[model samples]
Target: MASLEQPILISFKLCPFVQRSVITLLHKKIDFTIEYINLRKKPDWFLEISPLGKVPLLRVKEHVLFESAVINEYLDETHGERMLPEDPLARAEHRAWIEFSTSLFNAQHQLTQARREETYYKIEEDLTKKLAPLERKIGDQGFFEGDSFSLVDSAFAPFLMRSQIVADNIGVDPVSDYKKISKWRKNLLSLPEVQKSVVKDFEDLYMEGIYERGGYLADQ
Candidate 1:
């Protein structure tokens, strides 16, 4: 077995950004220390380490890395496990999908933290529009690239998990409309490695804290 090093992940239990970092760590099977933080009142140590005072900062040895995407890339580069493809074009494609996934989440789900029905619909529309490309890209493939899980899958998993919450909350069946995406999501979820690394209840993670009086919106 390769010698393992301990990494400190500054994290929030429910933050998607933090979840991205966690998923990457899990995908790599890297052992890490979880330092849960409170966004309402961030720790002094966290601010010092992250500068941006964001959760999902990583401390490996004496080096510190911040921003979930940057931290994830750093982990891939430094860790023995290689989630990225060796081919240049494939690597670029992986990065492109990763960006697409994160952007979709920011556009679709982040604003709903206010838990407003109007906001939910707006996010849903954006998601519906975005799904076509992703569906086309992932159709009937074993993975996004057609054979193996890559950084693209790890990057998208967190948002897909959150999207299920949106679909459930709005009573919109994403799986029905976007069968390819649904299948892709199922494939990603079914990965034993992904299952092993997940640490939270995803349904609750998105829905529990969102609505004041929890239930689906009418006509949603």
Candidate 2:
């Protein structure tokens, strides 16, 4: 393994993608510093380096990296213990699910911003349909793949956390009916890495953002 200097992570307080990378870094027990930036008021230097102008830009020794998944894979490849599977087939499957997790994030965004009852239920229905396959695939083990935590768990943790937070705010239980998902969520939440991945005021900031946007959940 190469000896890597502690990397600097440029992050936004509320981004789930950034949270994924944070969780991976923490789980792997790699040394890194996080610099929080406002997405609305991105610095010129940030825009100059990041083609996408996104958060979770990583500054490795003399180089920069963008995209949460790419950064995470790079870290796993170069830094501490690997989170991905050694088997090529298994690794491919994990990567596929990681991509699927992004769709869940999209659903969460739609659900949060929905103001009308019809729109809310529509998105909720679609979300439920999406989760059915995961519910079937997840085993009785503690984490997503098995007893050990992997990148798939890190990838999906933010989505599950967001769902529970929205449910708490709206008095609706989105994942409660899915037994496997609920168990997996409980397991993920119990991990220190997942719990400490976000800022100290994460819940307050998340709720306030929804309320400020006049979301249906906030109204309820």
Candidate 3:
């Protein structure tokens, strides 16, 4: 494994995956630098190191790690107390849920890109179905597993945060039908790590991006 030396996180401003890693880093109180890159015009050096040409790449000395889940897991294992459960079975369950949350992000992405109201509704319905299990399982105390914040909460925070932003801008709430999910999302959004994960102008930039894409929601 590569050693950390003022480790760097390569980011694209609106990337939820990158924001996930940022939340982990912040929650751990690790000292690291973030280098924002323009995804439209990725630099040659970045292209050389990033296998998938994606954001949320971690630069630890000469070693580079791609994929947000891998980067976040690496950060969790390398610094501070582990966010995952110590029990193997429980930890695996958490990992699976984190993977599930990634799918929700994809659905949200589709929702934002749907150009027709019909298409948008279809994507939304899919997202809602995906949240059904979470609505049943989210602990009443807060966070994913309970009162303690873990990697699962961080994994899902970006999607909820963006959902709220979209709702605030367009009056469409994704979790409205699921009371537990809506409440869970509110608590997730209030965390300091989640709050500080995005750029200072995130809401403006996010809304502007949706308009630029000319999605159906943009018209609202």
Give me the candidate number with maximum TM-score. Answer: 3
lDDT of 3 by residue, 1-220 (tens): 2245788999999999999999999999999999999999999989999999999899988889999889999999999999999999999999999999989999999988999889999998899899888888788766888788999999999999999998898998868888878878889899899999999999999999988999988888
Model 3 TM? 0.96
Mind giving the per-residue lDDT tens digits that candidate 1 earns over 1-220? 1112688887787777777778788778788887776789976767766777667778877878888878888888988767888889978887888888877877654445435677766766776788788888884774776677777777777776666656667655555587777877778777775665456575665565666444234334
The lDDT of each candidate is: 0.71, 0.88, 0.90
Candidate 2, 126-189: lDDT as tens digits: 9888999999877778688778988999999999887778777677777888998999998998
Error of 2 at 91 (Å): 0.6
TM-score of 2: 0.95
Error of 3 at 68 (Å): 0.8
What lDDT is obtained when candidate 3 is compared to the true structure? 0.90
Strongest candidate by lDDT: 3
Worst 10 residues of 2 by lDDT: 1-10
